[model samples]
Target: MKRQVIVYKMEGSIVRRVIPSDNSCLFNAVGYVMDHDKYKAAELRQVIAATVASDPTKYSEAFLGKSNEEYCSWILNPEKWGGAIELSILADYYGREIAAYDIQTTRCDLYGQEKKYRERVMLIYDGLHYDALAMSPADGAPEEFDQTIFAVNPDRTIGAYESLALNLVKDQQRKRSYTDTANFTLRCGVCQIGVIGQKEAAEHAQATGHVNFQEYK
Candidate 1:
């Protein structure tokens, strides 16, 4: 889908900052919101690794689906992608709540919400990739003037902001903005082998040691 800027009523415009799809989009997205730098993937990976290494019981094998050592090592790899666990850790580390909106499901998963963080950031997950959400002063305003972090409160302002985000997501959904990973076709970039869906892609990768795959319409 073509990149587009969405307006959020009279307050400002809700824009999606397209992050690089280098398998580190999640980290890059988080970095963009936190520091306005999308190239901090390596540093974010180290942050996750150090956080996991510092506490094993809290991030055990049962919860991480792998040993603490293995998980930390895997997370540090630039090819490895971060997900819910990384989001949770980063939320606590940065002392802010993260609200990730899934384009496929229109569901908002709020991490560190129970901790009652004073601020929150937003992200958009399109099945396989992640992008950050920021509010600009105008529909075509420069991103440097965008506001990525928002205050979290019990007042209606927070509710209105969330509503605007949801509406933007719904608008994207109508434009077919998300990838349907379950049915999307992928081609092995290394061997030019055709694969269907994420399950088949993983199987093909494990069987042929081809880690490069690209989605094809």
Candidate 2:
């Protein structure tokens, strides 16, 4: 069998590659970044609603333009999405500095929260969509990027990420996105032989009719 390679170059170092399986990309991105895996848009909406409601003095219309009732309804609706609003509430809740990166320019763009000394996390934007990127585990692949930090500031803008800078996002776009995998082993459950990655795992499964797969620590 032939080997599938992930093309990687020096641009912006990504911590981890999170593919958006659904519209919950923004929520998933945030969850994956903070070690917070709660990805339901409605559940996320509820969390923020309660937080904002508890303190109208801190979370104001400046942050939430719509009334609490209306805002809650909007986020709960699957059609409505999450972005900076959700990021800010979460940053405040977690007491971390969330950095929002505008990939178009090589700068560490806007951030959430005014207070300094907070730990940082990353959030990426293509001008229309949002996703999460973080540092790979210590035992991960692409050794060069193991310690890359993705600190972002929390900021909100509608329709701001519609236009993506291909050059900036090329690394995390598709199959190539798996470029830097953390140190783990993908083994074929049937053969007990180790394979390199997802493609190999799929090919091995197809050729040997082995559907069972496992990842080892």
Compared with the true structure, all predictions reach lDDT values of 0.90, 0.57
lDDT for model 1 comes to 0.90
Kindly list the per-residue Cα lDDT of model 1 for residues 1-217, writing each as its tens digit: 9999997556786788999999999999999998999998999899999999999999899999999999999899888888999999999989999999999889999999888888999999988999999988887888899899999877513656788889889988888899898899999999998988889998997798888889897
Model 2, span 1-217: residue lDDT tens: 9999997543332454553645566766666566645365556667877877777766666668777666766666654556777877777766666666644443444455476533666677653356665544443555334432333324422211212223345544533332223333677777898876556765787689775656664
Error of 1 at 160 (Å): 1.7
Highest TM-score model number: 1
Instruction: Give the number of the best model, judged by lDDT.
Output: 1
**In each prediction, how many residue pairs overlap at the backbone (N, C-alpha, C within less than 3 A)?**
0, 20
Where in model 2 is the C-alpha error above 4 Å? 1-16, 36-40, 57-63, 137-217
lDDT of residue 51 for candidate 1: 94
